[model samples]
Target: MSFRQGAPWPIPPTATGKVQMKNGYHQVKYTWPAAGWRYEARWHERTPWARLITYPSWRLDRTRPGKGYGPDAAPRLTETWVGDHWLPVSRLRYAAARYNHGCATSTDIELLKAAHPAAKQKKLPGK
Candidate 1:
């Protein structure tokens, strides 16, 4: 931990946590590397996107799918969830445009179940 002489606050250490949320057909876990930093926003994962990867974490997952990648841009899943619906897994970039609008959360699934009638009852993982 580090603190500034004049400031009353201490700089918190980097912490990590995992978040798994599902809305529509999208389900994935995001790892947060720093403490006290939680992503707060709305989120949608569109179909037809590709896997996204975050380095240092070196984790890989599918949200959509990407065609190619370079050194500077770490590989990331193509996102597709959007506006209370699940599209067929073929729309490129899925709903990449909307991701900047919000982050996803566990409660969104509750909202989705309230809106859509056919959502599969999810079983607890590892049960």
Candidate 2:
């Protein structure tokens, strides 16, 4: 767990714990990294958007199946959760556009669930 006392508007997923925003508010966040899925949750002093977020393997990687490329060239899952919606984000540009929009990646859903109980119910859109 990390702390950003006076960070900018968009906080990086890597920074966890209590984040001090410019608006004089604190956002509590937790992230989990996994091999097949990633889960994250963030909440603030005031009402916030969907506090629960999740990502699947396909959305995590940009490399089209059979197309092996450098790590930087590969498409990565969006770390930020900008809106209230869950997953099934199809637009490549949409996912790429949001910077610092997600939390840490987690390989263990069970561990993630411990932090954010709601995570269990917020499954991958179609699954």
Candidate 3:
């Protein structure tokens, strides 16, 4: 699917080992190349009380030579996880938000189970 500005993060439908829970937040980090660009993303989420907050940051670098290249080559864009106030709503974040509101679908519940195993047993907000 297209990962546009308003679209969800590229979370695979199947289970993956990349998912994790750290410091009270669910996280997924990976890198991949697409259409001649290399991308690295660090996505994480936390549901404190009743709200789900997500930080999806990434950096994209040009892998192939292009006309837009200047004398000094550098990444096209870079966004770190820290100092992010404009939180965008990604697919993963949307799913977490739904779960927090007690309107989770099967896929959303499955994601929660994978990201936070404790959620399977406890009545957690992200679960």
TM-score of each: 0.17, 0.29, 0.29
Q: Give the candidate number with the greatest lDDT.
A: 3
lDDT of 1 by residue, 8-111 (tens): 22222332223344543333333222322232112123323323211111111124334366764544333223344433323323233233245534344333
Q: How far out, in Å, is residue 13 in model 3?
A: 9.2
Q: Looking at candidate 2, what is the lDDT of residue 90?
A: 41
- Best model per TM-score: 2
Candidate 1 regions exceeding 4 Å error are: 1-69, 84-106, 114-127
Tens digit of per-residue lDDT, candidate 2, span 7-108 = 222344563343335364344454445444454445444323333333211111111223247664544444332232333334323333332255333422
Q: Candidate 1: worst 10 consecutive residues by lDDT?
A: 53-62
True-structure lDDT of candidate 3: 0.41
lDDT of 3 by residue, 1-127 (tens): 2222211234333312255677665655455666664444444444443243223323211233245576876544432221222222254466677887789898865543433222111221345
Instruction: List per-candidate RMSD values in Å.
Output: 17.4, 14.6, 13.0
Q: Is candidate 2 or candidate 3 better by lDDT?
A: 3
What is the lDDT, from 0 to 100, of the residue 119 in candidate 3?
Answer: 16
TM-score of 2: 0.29
